[model samples]
Target: MPDHASESSVRPETPEPTGTSKPSRATESKPEGEPTERPESSEAPGMSEAPEFRDAVPSPPQVPAYAQQGRQPQPPNPWQSNRQTTGTLARLRPARPAAIRNATLWAAVATALLSALLLGDGLGPNLLIVAVPAALAAYFAAQAAGRRLRTWSAVWAVGGLALLAVPALRDAGWPTFLAVVSAVALGSLTLHGSRSWLGVFLGSVGLLSSVAGGLRWGMGGVRDRMTGSRGRWGVVFRSTVVAIGLLIVFGALFASADAAFADVLGNLIPDVSLGDAPWRIFLFAVGLVGALTAAYTAAAPVRWDDITIRAGKPRGRLEWALPLIVLNLLFAVFIAIQLTVLLGGYDKVMAETHLSYSAYARQGFWQLLWATLLTLLVIALALRWAPRGQSRDRTLVRTVLGALCLLTLVVVASALRRMGLYVDAYGLTRLRISVAAIELWLGVVLILIMAAGMFGARILPRAVAASAAATVLAFGLVSPDGLIAEQNVQRYRSRHTIDIDYLRGLSADAVPALDSLPEPLRSCALKEIQQTLRTSDAPWYATSWGEVRARDILEKRSANALVANCRGQGSEGGSGRNGVEGDDSYDPY
Candidate 1:
């Protein structure tokens, strides 16, 4: 026997036992490049089974300890796995700061108190007193919420404040109502960081959301604070309770000790009666909800401009351009007719149509207004579906839409001219003046759209909004009732007739113009307004400039005696119809 173990260790690639010895199946199936294994022969050396020989065989790679123990790896804990993700979100978007919460809370309280003290009686200077402080408080609260007052935001804020002045300047119900609505819209835009028209609408939605969810959001913050540090919150609560108790005890004693002090206290504090509690609470709740809504919106403003609306699928050139071209031709035809009627052919057209000037104007004015509005819609839709793959497509869109805008402006002008004719024929009324102003404003908007086509539309939405606001402000400043009264008075001077009943229904804003009328007519026109002024007992803070002027005019002219003496003055030729009643025959709607 040779030293088989030594030989095997030295030459692991040696051939297996030959002849009678059979090789194992593993050795027989082994590839040619692999080393041969030892044969199980009795005469084979026992040292071949030693650790050194066995160690020469290769093994698989090591596995995890758990796998080695014949068990699968344990699943991760779901709660622990989400810790990092939640931590990241918390770090990225923290809650509103305590300072902002406190400031806004105080603002709500102040707004509530001011509302109870200065509002709810009537519309006047007191509106300004209440609105200005509330707006300023909201502005400062927004600043605390980390909103920088940029130029646009500042413009909106200032515009809102200016609109609030309408009540102080004029006493007409419609103008004051419009001012309040516009002011609220602008305030929403300012608080929610909206600059586009779509953003304006979305900001309105955000305002409603804030109103609906603001209380819950505030309570969430309170819950967090109370739960985060109980000891600190408990101490604060006890301190607040003790402070209130001490204040009540000391304040009652001081108030009773001196009559002057009691009077001063009475003046400083609101009179809170059990009977009036519900109304006062309702007013305070309204103010609180408004202030809190603003504060909540400012703290976490929605980026409304970031919302994108996908455009309609673009059409082929012929498909998109054909309808617009036909519409443009129609618009051209209408413009040609309008021009024909406007130029020296008005008499011929009116004669052929068998209609008076007023009838012609009234019949066509409303239709033209609708046409103008629909043309705008058509242009918008055309632009949305216009072909957009080539420069020629862009040129076509600009041409068609621009032509449509220009034609719509002509229609607006026609409407306004017809309104002028109607007003000339039958004097001015609130409806006529308001419609004319709207037509003029629409014309301005069309001009803006045309300019936008030349340049870019990035500023178009805000410009339109600003123009609307400016229109409203200018309308208020000019005093619509006063203008109507003045125009009617001038018409009366020329025609030697007046609608005394129509003028009598006017607000105090028309006092000066009505006061200029001839004796009996003036007395008839000012009768209702004079009685109103005498009966009103609004506080000084709630008195408007229009009211003050009306009172002064009435006192100087001794309008009471004139109105008393004017009995059956209408039959004395001071009041008569200048033309057919325009409102009954012509429905502008």
Candidate 2:
């Protein structure tokens, strides 16, 4: 087979030289080490030469310039990729500190300072400004400490040790300051365990402090922060509108003849303090929570789509019982007050010297009852008779009813104003019958309206509509109190009276009588007597408010005596009054 194949290849070189070329064919047959090829004719029929063997696939082209270099073409493993990603993040992250010692230190220092200030035992309004700042600082510090502190034990020990150092700073009355400082430190430490709860606790504490101290400005800031992230401007705007309405309505309800706008503003903006204890602060907190919660709850349903199903009419067990609840609250308060007056052992001495627990309770009870009843009545009237459907007469009825309500409110306010003046002039402290009679009448009117309006277009609308209506209702019905105006004047008058009258009776025996009076009254009496002894030549005309009022009556007094002197330093062309005159400017200084 090999000889035949080699002969066929050699003969193919030349057709005519086949015999001579056949020698090469002999050489091809005996080719040293090389394998022999068979003749084409001897191969299988119609067979072709086998193709050259090479790699099954071609090599990939070189990577482009933009491609990452120095990496092999390895298939990706999801697990490995994830690990790399996570490792990169781990490297970039910051390490947690072992302990927030600096934060703890600062918190401790602040707490100590507040405690020392509190020790005076007469901190009162004097410490309000400082207490608010202390509370805020403690809140943030707690957040930091939460990151580092691992256990409640550590938190308490650190906070306690910090407070213990309070006594060492004697110059500031560390002992007293320690009490307040310790309270803050402990409270803040407790907040470290849970941030959300911390926010709640801190918010609550801040609220209460604000209320007790009458620190409306401070509280307003806190509320802003809590709700700022909500991105719900409508909620905020509506709440503001409602608040304005509430203030207006409340003002109208309790408007006093002696009320002045300046005094009202002052009351609205408190000096703030914690010395009043946690309870008073709690009330402040409650009022703030009430306002904020009302705002948020009222707005939440409108904005949150998922919660819309729960947003239908407020028809729960709570809604059904609301009318009864309101009535019970009013009656319970009234009954308690009556029982205190008729059966309780409160005497005239107790009333004159200091209000007993029962007296304050009764006062609060009645005030609460009055406010609640009026608010409920407003609600009932709005729900029942506030016009339904899109009929023109309904709108007309609403307008008429609204106007009539406003008129009725004004008339009631006017009557209350006259009565307050009458009581003040006559020195009649008792007011049980007046408040109850007023609330009772208001509640009756409300119940009747609620009964009539139950099945109508739920005329009160939903929360938004209700809020708008309530706001309008409040403005139409309520009036701001001039408690500040009358209180300041009354205090001044009381002091002036004691000064002029008490000193004239100040023989040696009169010292005991002076001591028997309260501290403020005692102080006024002593100061006048001492001054009289020091300046025996002074005339009675020099010490009279009648004289001061006479001078300032036409002059438009600039604040008080000091401000009057300061007026001389004003710009030469400007008048001394500068618009702060009148009763409005009396204590505005």
Candidate 3:
């Protein structure tokens, strides 16, 4: 047979003097060394054109524009490109250096131990000690992991420490509670480069996410080491176990051998009984998780600002302006009425309403508070929907929102004035003072909004947050319970009325103020606080400054005399009241 492979590979020559009479221009335009088509019938049986003889050929790869211009193609940025794959999970999965891992582990252990020792007592000076050290440890761990602390991180960390001092300084429940919340919020913002309201919210969420992610990352590292390497880690683990066993054995023998050594050991180590073991373990776990979360976040903070939320669709000038204008007019009318009431017309209005001053104040204050809150919400929504792209739109937004904010300030003032009147009639309570403080804060926030409007809103969210933190700090520093006691005592001196039961409910921070009351009343006021102080056997480390001062004050007084007078007052049902009937509207929150 003929050589079919060679025949198939070679292109068949065109016959001279083709039927077309002359070669077509299209065929003439074909490039040299290109393959020519052949009929299948001309080939041998079961043979066809070879693969190389096919009409189509792959094209050469195109050169990039930069490469063609004598520049090398830049590598894609890992941070800015391929967001889908390079997300939080991918970032968290990188192998940490052994040194960094060990440092993080040590920091977590230290935090856990500190928390277990100091936290079980109560909220006190111990919180300050534990929190500051824990923050420092997290900072060091982050640095060990090659994460540089940013300026805002330092600011937030310092702010958190300052807020944590509230518990050490004030024993008032609400102030301490608010301070802890503010501190935790600031802590979350430490690593996350948050600069907006959305960023703040996501930073909080990221804190929780870091907790679980850090646990998984840490456990994975441990699992890998346990399964992969039996050389160094195994010996280290075995040595640790041996050391622990030796310590337990030697410690017990030595404690049994000497009384002074036993006392020292008992004092040095926390007494973890079987019943308290679970609680202590829980506290330790919290500390470990908290520390690991902070370190993990610091090492790889999610760029939450990258997640952009599109603004609300802009409304037409008419659509946006009409409601706000109507609302502004309504506010103007309300302010007019409020101003009239603030003037000498308050008595006439009260008489027309058939309510006393306190009664009238009570009826209106809560409504005004709710109105103030709702107005803030409305302002937020208005700004969201406000028209912007045009000069006219900008002016409209500034004018309308500005007026709304200004009117809201007046509402805030009205709420505060109403609360003041209510307090004057009934004496101050924790709830009254707290609400007043909140109203004052709202007023400050409205002022911030107006300022932001005048200048710019870029810093408004952070400014608002700082203001809130400052308000809480100031509120704590003022010692709300002490102030309440002092005000009520003064009210009693002037009006000959006070709420003894309410005063008794205050914390030890009120001791100095309550101690100034006349005999039986003083005894009744100090009765509960004294009981708390007497019963509390908290160690010196857990005692707050407020608690220490209260103890000192009580020590100088006659407990026996106070107890005797308190018993007589209790027998006579001497729980003083402001003589006004209790109204259901009086909520002390």
Which one wins on TM-score? 3
Question: For residues 433-475, could you state the per-residue lDDT of candidate 1 as single tens digits?
Answer: 8878888888899999999999988888888888888899889
Name model 1 segments beyond 4 Å from true: 1-100, 219-276, 561-589
Which residue pairs collide in model 3, if any? none
lDDT of 2 by residue, 1-589 (tens): 9999999877766344322223355655785897554443433334434322111133345575546665666667865544534432123222322222233333333444444433233332323333443444444433543434356425443444434332221112222253345444343333322223223234223322222222332344445645665556567668989997998677656655446864564454333356655645454444333232222211111111111122223333334345544544554564454445445444753566486433344444445455555655554544343334447535444444333343334333433443343333222221323353444355334433433333443322222222322232232122111121233235334432122221323321233333334434444433433433344321221122222222232234111222112222211232322112233221111
lDDT score of residue 260 within candidate 3: 100
User: How close to the true structure is residue 182 of candidate 2, measured as C-alpha lDDT?
Assistant: 45
TM-score of each: 0.75, 0.25, 0.78
* RMSD of every prediction: 8.9, 24.8, 9.1
Superposition error at 48 for model 2 (Å): 52
Summarize candidate 3's per-residue lDDT along 50-113 as a digit string, tens digits. 4332323434566678988999877888767565565554554454433336666666767888
Select the stronger candidate by TM-score from 1 and 2. Answer: 1
Model 2, residue 298: what's the lDDT? 16
After aligning candidate 1 to the native by TM-score, how far in Å is the CA of 491 from where it should be?
0.5
Better of 1 and 3 by TM-score: 3
How does model 3 score by TM-score?
0.78
- Model 3 residue 564 lDDT score: 52
